[model samples]
Target: MLLNGLKVVEFASYIAAPGAAGILADWGAQVIKVERPGGDAMRHVFADAKSELSGNPTFEMDNRGKRSVVLDISKPRGREALARLAAKADVFLTNVRASSLKKSGLDEPTLRKANPRLIYAMVTGYGLEGTEAETPGFDVTAFWARAGVAMMTTPKGHDPFLLRTGVGDHTTSLATVSAILAAVYEREHTGVGRLVQTSLLATGVYTVGSDLAVQLRFGRLASNKPRTAPFDPVANFYRSADDRWFVVNPRGGAVDWPVLTKVAGRPELTEDERFRTSRSRKDNSALLVAELDAAFGAMAFDEIARRLNEADLAWAPAQTPAEVAADPQLRAAGALVEVDDGSGRAHLSPAAPAVFPGLDPGVLPPCPALGRDTRKVLEEAGFSAADIEAMYDEGAAA
Candidate 1:
């Protein structure tokens, strides 16, 4: 309820922009999603997939609790309607390309001119000012590949794999939300809104910033390796007797090596010459890893977990999706909530990351059907019934 009275008009599809607005809505903002006629491309994105589902969970995740309006912005009347919406919104959010936005008169300058106090937030694949500003980019190309994350994450000789859906977009959503809130705060003092922007590429770069920073200063980075032969053997995964994998992150400066050796029931190994110093252990990483593999493989997961905890080692099991879904810690932390899908069916849904103390993060409504609020939104924007009818009849509004 922190942003109870805030109004956001979102002109974006897919994940990034709408995801950001979804968080705003979670915090009690009234969000109006402006989609093109036939609705956002996301509506049909998974249509060809073979699955038994009543609704698109992906679409619902980013668009729930928001009103949807369909308008063909290419038409003058539709563009006029969008401008009217922007004029009354505290924030106008979009992921539409800069070129298209300008062409349709929905760019920052135009919208800000209409409402000086509006926060004009733009999400893009690249950025607003560049040769590729208008270039269409999805999270795969811009966020993963172009940002160097794909190359960095790919094994030394393996083909780069695509990221899971919305990973980058969701990350960028957090960045956009932070920027929007800051801009909102600034507007209180300046009495004017500003153009705030972020890009998938930029967000990706920041996500891998520590790795990229090392590469930038050192001129090169260690090649990606298989999990079994990671650069730091102490920071690696091992399988238990039960065949469950878990990761260990030993403390820096060789502080945890002796403790971990004892926990693995191989304290004698600490006296070995090849594993005495940090540099020596790294030099004999393969041998050290082999020993660790055998040691962990001999113990059941429960025993390994108990020993790791007893030794105060930082480690966690590599949980599967099913395991994650049943994690009591996640539930206690409010990572998921039950939401009604408008069919009187309550489904478990992901909750926004932020937690405001003393405030209930209210349940979200289901994603609206295509053009579900077109006429109502137009009416609220001060359009007369006759005007709304004419716009619909002229193929401008749906």
Candidate 2:
């Protein structure tokens, strides 16, 4: 319960913004999710999938342990209720477009006017000041397509593929959390909250900063090559006799060359002119990769693993999701946790990417049903029951 006393008012939908608040909730923050009537668009994602599953784990992952209050800020009463909630909150988070938020009087200036100590955090696709600032963007467009990730990741001459669901959004979510916490810390001294902004484009750029750095320095970057003709043959995947795949990344220079050569049962390769140095290996990568492929393919994965372990080589299996799900190390690393969904049951879900030794967040409460806490939250914000009922009657608050 590290953030036990913190209050986060989340006015966001989908992943990035809501996901940030989710991590805070995991650490014991009291999060109030202010959804528009009908709930977040994420609630319909599973329905769009046409799946037979009874639950929406994807939406639940980012919305768990929160109280929901439906409010249509397009109406005057809804905006009044939201402003009152913000007046007493520690943080206000959203991904609504800047123009729209300003129009609704929920922008930083408007909200901060009522509560100088409210932390206003926002997530955007491109950024806040660009010409396309108001342009609607999703992770696929801003993070992957516009940020050079898709180009750099796709192999030369290969068709580009979509990024796995929520990869970029969740990465942006973590960045937003980091920014929000930093602002929270700053508030301790300033006695005032600050505006914290994070964007998909920026996160995507940072994600591939190393590659971008090379491109920046050289004005160009080498296109990705297929595994067979990888730029570095020593760092490549190979198949075993049983057809299992594993990747190896041996040490640079001649340090691990002799060991690798011996382990491959081809000690002469260390002395071979084409494979003598790192540069030469790169120059003749395809040939070296072929040799390694043959050598590894001659032995079963178990035997290959033993030799690699004996040599202290760096290698790992290309594990499938099912394998990773059942991996004992995943639990040991605290990468997953069981969440109580208030259905008299607990389900396994991925944990936030960090751990506080003593502040362990064991089992979390369920994500609230849409508008389940509207009356309670409104009353906590100091609204009278009659006032809350009036707003509900007017379709302002539900």
Best by lDDT: 2
Give stretches of model 1 more than 4 Å off.
Answer: none
| Reference-based lDDT, each prediction | 0.91, 0.91
lDDT of 2 at 52: 75
Give the per-residue lDDT digits (tens) of candidate 2, residues 57-170. Answer: 899999999999999998999999998999999999999999898998989999999999999999999889969887787889999988989989998999999999899999
Each prediction's TM-score against the native?
0.97, 0.97
Q: In candidate 2, where is summed lDDT lowest over 10 consecutive residues?
A: 46-55
